[model samples]
Target chain A: MIAPLLQGFLDEFERLEAAMPGYEQAWLRQLRRDRLDAFVTSGLPGRREEAWKYTPLKGLEQRAFALPRGSALPPPLPPPLDAVRHRLVFVDGRFAPESSRLPADAEIEFLPLSEVFRNHDAAARFRIARLMGSGEDALDHLNAALATDGLLLRVPAGRSVREPVHLVYLGSKQSSGRAWHLRGLIELEGGARLRIVEHFYDGGEEAELSSVINEIQLAADAELELVRFQDMGARSILLSRTRLQVEARGRLRITAIDRGGELVRSEWLTTLRGREAHGDIAGVARLRGRQHADQVVEVRHLERDTSAEVRFRGVAEDQSRAVFTGTLHVAPGASGAETRLSSRNLLLSPQAEVDTRPVLEIHHDEVVAAHGATVGQLDPEALFYLRSRGFSETMARAILIGAFLEEISIRLPEPRFAEWVSSRMGLDHPLPWGGEKT
Target chain B: MLEIVDLHVSVGGTPILKGLDLRVPRGEVHAIMGPNGAGKSTLAYVLAGKEGYERTRGDIRWDGKDLLSLAPEQRAIAGIFLAFQYPVEIPGVNNAYFLRTAVNLKRKARGEPELDAVEFLRAARERLRLIGSDDGLLQRGLNEGFSGGEKKRNEILQMLMLEPELAILDETDSGLDIDALRLVASGVNALRSPERAFLVITHYQRLLEHIVPDRVHVLAEGRIVASGGPDLAQRLEREGYGWLAERRRASEALG
Candidate 1:
């Protein structure tokens, strides 16, 4: 039964292949077939896996999702549109280029994944195979089996792109158990530098599931900074994963912000492959009203003289729940490797729950590796100080929350993205004092 | 400007201040000198309306208005400032921002125009220079990682910005060098006016030399045992509180 369903999913891949009729390559088609086969064998992860224990796949069993059929896109993008330098809109497993704005500079290469498969077959195959779900995980396999529309960004060698690339993923309107598996491949050549921002938004109020996978590879002396924003509606379920590989002297910085969703889980796995490589992973999750947000990150220091830092902050209000699990690994012979993982959670309501865990796995004896997790309410002293300064109790709480999250916000490479995240967290308005929302 | 009549306070069910009376009319700087555990700090905290200090029996009045009934912040807005002995260190809150909030709170209460950043900076710069402190201190969190002298100077800087009608200095001289102490004292002396009053609490006569208090009161076992002119501080410095405690014991024995 699973074989046929898996084959049916692969059949959809053939359709995507046929859609790009003008440019078809045999090697690219074979590689996609091999990846689909890998997905068929792996299937969905079960309770046995430690990473998938807390998050079960019970809801996924109840429905079968089909690929979206039509070319209907979402309404025109919202205002403050100038904030995004470039945008690629994907509606129901298909790219909507008409709704996007690309930069004029030819140094930064941006195209639909389908186009990349047709035009740049070798580059696409090498990136997808090396960065995609080569691990022994079921969800990753499922994503590979049913992957459709997404983005492909490449920064040429010795070139530096000034603006950030934005990828906007929009879910379909139908209530079908349809899953939109989208993947983004960001390839930075040697001595290349770029910044990319990916946003996943759902316009419809229908119950649906969408999983997005992003793979980034930084060549020698290459640098890349990426930010992913997930702000779907309450009826949507999103499972997003990103894997990054940095080579010698390469630098990769990633920030993930989760604002709204019924159930959202994102994982980041970064590996430092060569000497002097650096990876910094930071994320913030704000949840309210029965929402669930989970972020898992792992940083591996496989070579000597490598350093990494992972920081995660979450605010849970109403009946919302948030979970953060961070791990830092330093392999043997990876001396002078310094890695730190810190996670802080703020519970805004009595019913709100936050679970944070930080793990450190070190096989090297001469390395500095530390992990810390703190879960609690706001500091009473700080709150009282703010209130005593003429701010109401509500304003006091809001200010302290902003202060707590400011540590991460200040580290954002882009100011506009930081402001956008702050606004989503309700830090834009003056705090409502005396139980009145202003 | 402020009156503490027969004030008694307790902490953790233990009596600390017993029927201590103090009156500071406008235009005078009164200093309270005593040894450790003499309830000097307690009096300052109680006057500032800090919680955790139970007032067993007392009536504190400011400008003929009952003060014990108000909250600490309310008391603060009413022009009662207490320079803490051991200032609390708050990390991540900028010093300039904290002072701005405090000043704005007082200004709004007084129905005065609040200063914006530019206006506040111009005024604060003068005050900071007057205290012999640098502008970098204003960019850091409140009292965080500050030296003892810097903390006391920051307190005086706050007083200068707020310009409270009545000020209480609780051991402001405890952790200062001679120069820092003189600077802090000069900062306080600059704010002395006929409309303002001060209650200076200290364990020694070192700071008194700078401000030159009009009267000095000695507090022992939670009550005032003696009151005299500035010479009393000189006498206490020479004779020490041991002789006074013996005389008080002898007087109690005769009674």
Candidate 2:
């Protein structure tokens, strides 16, 4: 009675079990089997699920995908960041030791997930068992079962890394119609600081799908800044979920930029576990053609004096659709919690659509929360003003769209990354000042 | 010359300008002094080709060319500029960049070479210096966070840079203090020449006192009810338009 797609996945898991990491560990084997069983029982999300209403998976359910086989050469990489010296590169969902530049620092543990499991690191296995499959849907369970390779990063207590660590996940040309499930774990000890830049790209232009699950834990007084950029092929689909827990006096800053892929769904779930924990999340999605992007964020204030802010800006044109749903919750007795959530979208064409929903469930009356969502066309007054100043309608619209997204792009971790984001959105027209000639 | 014949414009199905006619030959400044709701601002918007201002029946000719058929940018390229009463704030757009873009666009349309950044900035800085203003405004966002008087002054700053053939000032002195009023007037006077004409629209005659007009016209009921020399502006300032309304009512009764 099992679906054919589910049967195919099960068969693949059985065949690849010996080749997977931690194959000798009986506990990990049982753990993967239990999660796979859970996936089989639930299957792909259907139309009835409220969270999956906007993003349908019926098409994805009919297709069968297997793990990427063998190593393949990565496509041309993006230019290196000036401030980033430590690099980790993955090609075709497999770690590329040839392309990686490992860190020489002793205070940081930077290694592949396969190494962590193959070496039988008990500390990592414990955290992985505790944090995996924590999502509200079955996708996380699927990732937990099928994940083969990812990054495992840990910073010792009282240590700060001034230079950022870059992780590049590339779907090379040989990865067409292949799927990769990547799981990452990041642990920051008390008073430790670290910055990470994660980049995802499909160089082959025919990748089928990629699912990434990252679990982040920050201890007391820890600080972490994570920036992720996703630019996949037009035929590919990307599903990602990041679950984070911030303890007392911890600070977490995250920025997610989605610019490519036919379909993308990004979810960030954060729980403030201790007092004065703060989370700042900002995202931008620029989509055109028939592309679709959905971002869901939920921040829970479980302790007093915790604060969080989630802001997103989306620009959809040419029949593309962008969706943002934010939920801010204040647990009972978390009276001093404060939160701000906003999603503003611009529909550039008649066929373009955007849906934004901001929900605030404040259990405590003393908490201050402000949330707003707006979907509108460009300001007609501003448009007319620009036209009256001799700018063509196209140029005028581009300028206004650039201005709309400037607030978020300017804060990118790297200064040049802002330029890259603007160029990807086609907003990098030569200006009178910075540009030599127009 | 700029010529308008029997212009009729309506906004959102309500008529604002009905059967209006005017002409401004080159080498002259005309002041339009009218009461509120007399289509003074509407005339400026219509001339600049703003959308939603339906020109049901009108012929706007600029140097014998049909103007209404052209788009707003086309009109702007043809040397028409309107200083807004409430200048719009364009956040994230640098003032100098915007001014330079507009200037270069006009120049390119006219088959003239565009100025580079250095040349453009030098010219702009000179203009600011001549107007007794600083260069700080050029670095900020266009009209963003500007005070009331500063917004009006910024409009004049734009006019100075654009150097349009037909400049329309729509209540450009409403919220300006005397000092700002004088600075804006000087900025305008600096651009005055035989090859350009100005249409200054205002509710009060204070701006006219600084940039004395060659001709003054009183607009009422969407038509030019009276036109005379500079003395007419002084007369309206003293009489407060009471006699003009009485005269209009008398004419209506006769009809």
Candidate 3:
């Protein structure tokens, strides 16, 4: 009974495969085959996997989702990044030329993969062939198999782009119930620096199942800052994954502000492949009305003198659920590895739930690794103190939650992004630390 | 003015304040001196509207208003402030931002315009300097990682920001050194006004020496056992509560 239906699901997917732009290219054909064959064996990951135990995928099942027809007109992207002149827009996971405004600069290679390959850049032409088939993440494999169009960005050695590059992925109303996969590639060479912002939107009422995979490669002494804002609509399901390889003296700072959907799973997988590399990751989540959000972070320190720090704040209200799982694995010989993980959560109602797991598997004695997590209500005393200062109960709660989330704000590479996050979380109280002058 | 008549309070089904009676006119600093288990902290908690402290029978009138009928924040807006004995440390909340929010909320409740960040920063800097503190404490978390004295000074900073009409200092001088004691005392003295009242609860006469009270009352076994001038605190300091407890027992027996 199940075999025929599985075959049908794959046959229906062939319709989407036919509509892809670069479906006939020999290199892309080989890449898709490599990823799809692996995905076919295991199927979609389920709750049995240790890393996927808390994420339920019912919202993504039982329905046929096809590729969407791009709309002639779509709503403008949400700001403070809307005014960003260097934005590249993608509708239904395909580059939309009408909606994007691209600027050219000598230091940046911000364009599509087809354009980069046409320009005969050897480094750009071999990216997918080199990095696509190596990851074990099931979602990454699925995205690589389905994706046909996405942005490719590169920063040459010793050059820094003055303006931040922005990428906006708009899910059109016509894209309802369509499962799309978007893939992005970013590479930074030695002593290069850049900042990128990625935004995702679910533009319709019907459920949209989507997956995104970002592959990043950083050379020695490289630096990159990335901020991601995701709201997959009220009924959408998203599997977003980011994988990075950092060399010696490379730094990667990332912040994720997530207001999740019916089902959303966001993962960060990083490997410190060289000495003196560092990764700092922070995120804040607000979930309500039976929504489910899961954040997973894994850092592998394979070399000496590597460090990583992760801090997450979550608030779940109205029968919602939130999960934060982090793992810092220091190999036996990776001495001088310093890693820290902290997660704080507030459950507004007794029905709301938060599960936090900060695991440390350190095999070396010369490393400093610690994990601290707390799941509780607002401090009764602090709540009383704030209320005793003339703030109403609702306002008091908002202020404390804002203050709790302020930890992520101070560490933002673009501090102005804090305002957008505070308002997005429905916490408009006066921030504990006043907004900066800028 | 503040008045409490036959106040009876309980906590977790256990009686804490039993039939306590007290009154203070406006512009008077009245100190409640008592030993351990005398319900000194209970009095402050009840007046501040802390949960779990049930008022079984009581009538508390603050400035011609029924205080027990109001919520904690309403009581705050109506000019009642309790400087906590142990100020809580709330990480990630900046001290200056916390105070400014409190002040602006109170002002908004009273039909006043709000102050922007610049205006609030300037005003808080003045108050910080007046309290003999610096901006470093303001930049840090609200009482987070602060020393004992620094915590007490932060309480005073809030008081200075809100400028409440009635202030209850709950053992504000308990763990302070001599310098902190003088600083806190001076900060309290600076807020003395014709329309204000003070209920300073202390276990020692040392604080009274710095800010002399107009009257001193002795509390024991959940009631005001005796009342007199500042000399009473000094006498209680010199000679403990044994004599007062014996006299109260004899009076109860005779009655």
Q: Find the 10 residues in a row with the least total lDDT in model 2 chain A.
A: A429-438
Chain A (alone) TM-scores for all candidate structures: 0.87, 0.94, 0.92
- What is the C-alpha local distance difference test score of candidate 2? 0.85
Task: Give me the runs in candidate 2 sitting further than 4 Å from their true place.
Answer: A80-84, A103-107, A127-136, A173-175, A204-207, A429-438, B108-118, B242-255
For model 2, residues A1-438, the per-residue Cα lDDT tens digits are 777667777989999999898888888788888888998888888767878778877567777777777778878777644345777888767788887776686358888888767775677678666655466457977888888788888899999988787888888857467888888889899999998888888675675778888889999999999888887777778888888999999999998888747788999999999999999999988898888998999999999999999999999999888988899999998988999998999999999889888988989998999999988888888888899989988889888887787666666765466566566677754331132221
- Give the whole-model CA lDDT for all candidates, comma-separated: 0.79, 0.85, 0.82
Question: Residue-wise lDDT of candidate 1 within A105-213, one digit each (tens)?
Answer: 6577777776665555564667655544455466676666566556777888999887766777888565555667787777899989988777777666777778888
Docking class of predicted structure 3: acceptable
Worst 10 residues of 1 chain A by lDDT: A429-438
* Steric clashes per prediction: 1, 0, 0
Residues B142-200 of candidate 3: C-alpha lDDT, one tens digit per residue:
88999999999989988988999999999999999998899899999988888889999
**What DockQ results do all the predictions give, each relative to the true complex?**
0.13, 0.44, 0.48
lDDT (tens digit, per residue) of candidate 2 on B87-114? 8998877788888989999999989999
How large a fraction of the reference contact set does each model reproduce? 0.11, 0.57, 0.62
Task: Order the candidate numbers by DockQ, best to worst.
Answer: 3, 2, 1
